[model samples]
Target: MLANGNVLHPRAGRAYVLRGGRIVVSADEIRNADILVGVDGRIARIGEGVSDPGADIVDISGRLVVSGLVDAHQHLDKTGVLRFTPNPSGTLQGAREAFAKYARNAPPDDITRRAERTMARCLSRGTTAIRSHVNVDKDAGFNGIEALSALRDSWADRLTLQLVAFMTPHPGQDLEWLEANIDAAVEKADVVGGTPAVAEDPFRYMDILFGAAARHGKPVDLHLDEHLNPQRPLFDAVFDRVRKFGLEGRTVLSHVSVLSAMPRDAFERVRNEILELDLGVVTLPAANLYLQGRDADMLPPRGLTRVAELVRAGVPIATASDNIQDPFVPTGAGDMLEIGRWTLLAGHLRGDELKTVYSMMTDIPARLMGLGADYGLREGAFADLLVTDCADVDTLVAGGADAMTVIAKGKPVFDTASRPVAGDEHRQPAGSG
Candidate 1:
């Protein structure tokens, strides 16, 4: 404890010792120990009975310690749209129109305020970093772009913000215009995002976009098919181009739910292609689930990408809360734990599969964000961590990381105090007898 209530301070590597918790150093290492987070917000020392007199300490004896979560794919501008109940007949068209209107009418300040609030909520829930796709289509007129850019700047200390400049290659704008604008946008952003669904000739469009990305030395993010019609071959074309350019490990495919509906044989071929290309997959559960099943019958495919298969085949797979109350997804409460729960349940993860589910939100995403070296709980890693209301990974998802504590750069960003209920305090009712 500090002499004052304030958590901010200056010291020569004063140790922060979290005593006696089940420390999840990584996905596999879960051990009971005193983990010391040193000054400058990195793990300095970790072991049993590690003590320091000048150190600040917290007793997390009954909880679990985990690395800060990361959402590898998200949409900052689309996060404030209210959740709409789906209309069986008007699902796709209605949702699209609603979002388009939201994008047009939403003021820049409103977008920035909502995105900042969403980022705070995500941080409170232990998501410390996110790569958000801000729609940069022709109609947005710098409002969305400026808003998202400002959001990234304002929260730079707490979050790792990667912008995907999503382009609109409408007929009037044409192929050449799209290429020129995309090249310029990369200099202004971290990645180049496009929608193959919006283009009449998606193959040719992807070629242009990917080529531009290679030329600009930026990554490629695609809002692939999230529809009931499963015949879109954009993923195939993506794999081919990435392979041809040898841009392995630099491309990301988002919302590829249509791939789930493909036959096993066809999926095998495409999956193999994706693996050979070594491209990354960002599964956005919130948006895809809301957008997909528009024309479904008895069996609605899980709108998630083939995460388990991809991970088993050594392909990098990550998760994101694409929208939080935005037009496309409607409502995403900005909680990654919620996304993890949906992933485990909807993706049929059980037993040991829980570890894989957990990785999607943690180290795996850190790798995607290029922070692998300093992402986790090991010594010399950043002191960004979460104290969860769980004994292990399985229980954490079930309990929703409740009563959690979030630490960023070795300082408490959020802390929840729990009080026992009156007359039901830690015992059975007396009237039961």
Candidate 2:
């Protein structure tokens, strides 16, 4: 044990055991087991009465342990700029205008500093992996990708950051210029991203993006049909391209909020098509809810994708914090739990539905990001887990559940219980104590 009351081995490749915690093995299963992480930073064993006398043991009896959270869709370049750039109209166009102006004036050093702070905040909240979309259009240039690539290497041990090159093109812009910028981004980014719904010609826009991705053999993640217009046919165009390029399971569509306004028959048809294509979907509840449905005169619709329905149809779907404190969404802490809460409320998840909602932030997104088979808390899985003071899912979902310990690759990186607080005794919650 160290001076902080947290037990962590000092030597390299040292073993440790987390004892007597309720481990969440899956969305529908929880077991009272002790986890033994081996010297290789993988789970050596997980079961009742599991023990390794040579390993250091941390007694976490009566605690709840779950896998680390995965945020599949996020905008790291625009994080923490809401105060400086406010969107009074709170519409998608308003956000675009505000951010475009800010990007022109913001320096690379300033962007890096803000992104680093956001990453630290995400780490403290038990997010072990993230897929962040960086701006790659002509206005922002390659500055966002360059900064994020450096940060990804610098913070490799604490967090896994996958950078996606996001191409945001304005109407009537020269396609040749946009294609050249995208080519530069693909040379440096892990994935290629585009917003087909905002393009002047959705088909040509998708053709350019898909052509670039195919030529480079990179995966595609597009922001499709983000508006409230139900008559827009951009989503069909995307499905056609995915089929034509045979990019099934390698493509992801984020923020299909327009589906919420579709008629029942049309919605089912599109949902089935998505399942057939084996494409993944990411819902941005915070940004969509704030930016969409603002023009409705009465009984405004909730700007969200069909989460429950898609999950029921065996479609791969996940939820994420799209914009953190930016012009699109002026409030967020980069917390998956908070995002889960919003999903629960907006998606109408309750009772056993809560389990699927929780998985949206953990297992579902991890699978979408193609995290390897050894991602969860199995025998051969990586030792990335979060131990909270809540003993059950309900308590954790009810809010105020403190993350007691966070382990990244078998190392105790965050210990909330050991942190010194400056406050009265009563102010601290029982779980943190």
Residue pairs in clash, model 2: none
lDDT of 1 by residue, 58-100 (tens): 6666677888889888878767656532323435456555666
TM-scores of the candidates are 0.87, 0.92
User: For candidate 2, what is the lDDT?
Assistant: 0.82
Clashes of each: 5, 0
Instruction: List the candidate 1 regions with Cα displacement exceeding 4 Å.
Output: 1-15, 51-53, 83-93, 170-173, 419-433
lDDT of 1 at 103: 63
lDDT tens readout by residue for model 2, 1-433: 4534545433456787787788988877888898998988889999987878677767777678889889999999999998888789999989988888788878888889999999888888888889999887767777788999999898876788998888888755667777777787888888889898877776787888898888888899888889889888487888888888878889999999888888989999999888888889999899888999999999888899887788788888999999999999998998888898888889766666777877888888888888877689888878888888764665565563544677887777777753433553422233321
Instruction: Return the top candidate by TM-score.
Output: 2
**RMSD in Å for candidate 1, one decimal?**
5.0
